[model samples]
Target: MSGGTWIAVDGGQSTTRARASWTTEDAAVAGFIQTTDGFAAVAANVSAALAAVPDAPGTIDRLVVGHTGLPIDHASRDRLARMLLADHPVREVVLAPDEVTAHAGALGGPGVVSAVGTGCVTLAVDAEGRGHRIDGWGFLFGDAGSAFSIGRAALEAALRSDDGRNPPSSLVAAVHEVFGGSPRDATWALYQMTDRIDRVARFAPRVIEEAEHDAAAAAIVRHAAEELAHACATAAEALPGIDRVAVTGRLIAPGSRLEREFIDALAARAAHLLTVPSAGSPLDGAARIAADGPSIYRPLVEILTRPESSAA
Candidate 1:
């Protein structure tokens, strides 16, 4: 391997982690860094993430980052590469949508990886490794069954109860406890903040916690499950004959309420499908790509080197 130092990052909406591996003629060293989350397209967030890495190996010989909010197109991905290259000392950079890495990490071959965390993104790769993305559209437009969607829905339910437009919900108390006394005021304040989506998404677990006794919360979780299942079905269809799905992210973690809901929903919609555990986390996928994984993934990422050279 042609390596001085190789760094791989998995940047998500909730967390950012970096791993640096350095090798010399006879010595090797490695270290790790973890930081708060950042939007994938924003340079400042990416820079902050990279800066947190401790090793200074002169220049990072190779860097691969799988991040949220990155567009799939070559121009947009390369644009992000350029921005990161300008800030960090690196010989080559590869940028891709976090789902790409999630898919690679979860299932190295032909299958679908439905990543449901603070955000939701699903990717299906055919036998040839051609990938089709489904429902990673962020909070504003899509991200159907994401934590943001569930939290936002629960907030709306709480607001409805507060407004006397709906029946009393225990979620109203949750709102009061989590967002101060007034639901409307706290929600308005959250909207004013830049991290509104993250703030809203943080409420998902509360809603899930109340699903056992709160009718409104149960309804919200049910709908969220339906949406998540739909995305999984779509991804599975894209994979041709794939009958099982691997999932990543915190939302559908093992033994969680949302995980149970998502599994039931998927069973209802696609009875033939099976829910499979992910082989590895997104970070594992990022490292594989950084090390040049199977050819199927090569076309899905944008790689930028020194000078004007860009590779597909």
Candidate 2:
């Protein structure tokens, strides 16, 4: 194996994590750091991660960063690459969308990956290496079947129940228990919270819990499962020769009712297809891409790997 230091970073909107490994002909050492997200925040975390190792900035060979809000355009990606090169002494760097790394970690090869967390997005890669992305339009217009969606639905149901527009539901009681107020008061408070999306998403587990026995909650869960399954199936259909779909993110935790329903719904739509479980975390995928030289992120990798003079 080649002897050098490699760094992998996963930068989400909530938190950022970086792993650094120094490998030589015989011995190797690894370190990890956690910090905030964003270009500057991730760079700072990367520096802190490398601080424990000797000759960090100068001796680093490769760095791969999968960030949540990275730009999709080539010019924008190149701009970010230049910024990273200027900030660090690493020989090469690769920047990719966090979803790409999530798909890589979940599928590791050609297939479809549906990530349902605070938000939802589905990606499919064809046999010929073409990619299709679906339903990542953010929380306002899209992100169907996400925790935020489920939570929002629950809140709506609770409000309807409180106002006597909908039949009384266990969700009303559940919402009152958590938020300690009437549905109207809870709704107003949700609007007042700074991180309303995340705060509202915090109620998703409760929705899931109530779904076990509450008809209204069960309806929300079923609807969520249907929406998520539809996204996965839609993406899969666009990618010819793909028979496997992998699911990632907190919303699809194994053995949960949500997962069971989602898989069943998806299986019904796509015959003879497999729902593969995620084999590794996104950080593992980032490391794999860094070690493998390049794949989907070849453009960014090439731009960063080129000599400074050539780049100029």
Candidate 3:
């Protein structure tokens, strides 16, 4: 079993977070750098992220990561593990798709987890260890009830009002307040930004805030929340008898509008499914997987150790 110094990497599209247990203490770093470039770039990005973390131990017992864009095939996974093993003073490396880690972090058992942040994904696992994923198709294809979708809808509503194609909305004024231009100019500014998704997603809170008193914003938020619930339900449907559901990220925080609406919608659609609070972040899940996770997650997470270390 792995013990002592451990490093957990949460490699995401928008930011990378690395947490490590030091020889004498614990240290963590949240470096706001995009880390997921694909299998070819994962090792370097993971290395860069690990370097950003402060106060690392000279040697590490295990490196656990829930990385975006990690290949699912066994050969690619082994190659990635080898690359990581070569770069760090680690005895073992556990690599998995970020979704698996998120699921483990949230429920840690048979349940459905819907993660709604800049992007969104719903994953479900049953008692038999069968898993199915829903949404997470990225902004262009789907990501149905994600922050990007809500923000884009808010901006579109503002532009629609400007063009008189739809009823006037307070979001038009909000567009000017945020982008300091007409609705059309706001659209142009967004299109010109180097990080369009982050820029757009930043505006989601404004939309959610206005949802309290604005019809247009409320409509968009309600639709997105309902869609999020639907996505979670769809994922849960594949899990057979599992009825537990959990949500993670800023959108689902306690009393947020999105969280409230999502819970209401979920109750309406799947009354038997219970929503539970997440145990921790994906980084925590990586640590759990590294230490050899519960039997339910064994089929989903792979813990790879050096032959010599395992033989010991």
Backbone clashes counted, model 2: 0
Q: Which stretches of candidate 1 lie over 4 Å from their true place?
A: 1-4, 22-41, 292-294, 307-312
Alpha carbon RMSD to native, model 3: 2.9
Using lDDT as the measure, the top candidate is: 3
Arrange candidates by TM-score, descending: 3, 1, 2
lDDT tens readout by residue for model 2, 51-119? 433555444678788765565567767767777777777777788666677777787788888877677
Where is the poorest 10-residue window by lDDT in model 3? 24-33
TM-score pick, better of 2 and 3: 3
RMSD of every prediction: 5.4, 5.3, 2.9
lDDT-sorted candidate list, best first: 3, 1, 2
- On a 0 to 1 TM-score scale, where does candidate 3 land against the true structure? 0.89
Better of 1 and 3 by lDDT: 3
* C-alpha positional error of residue 1 in candidate 3 after TM-score superposition, expressed in Å: 2.1
> Could you tally the backbone clashes for each prediction?
0, 0, 0
lDDT of 3 by residue, 1-312 (tens): 545677888776566777776633334443233335556677776888787766554667778878765776888888889888877778878886788788888877889988777788888999877889898877888888888899999999999988999898999998889878988998998798767787788788889999999999999999998998898888888778989999887766889998899899999999989999988777677767766543576676666777784322
Identify the candidate with maximal TM-score: 3
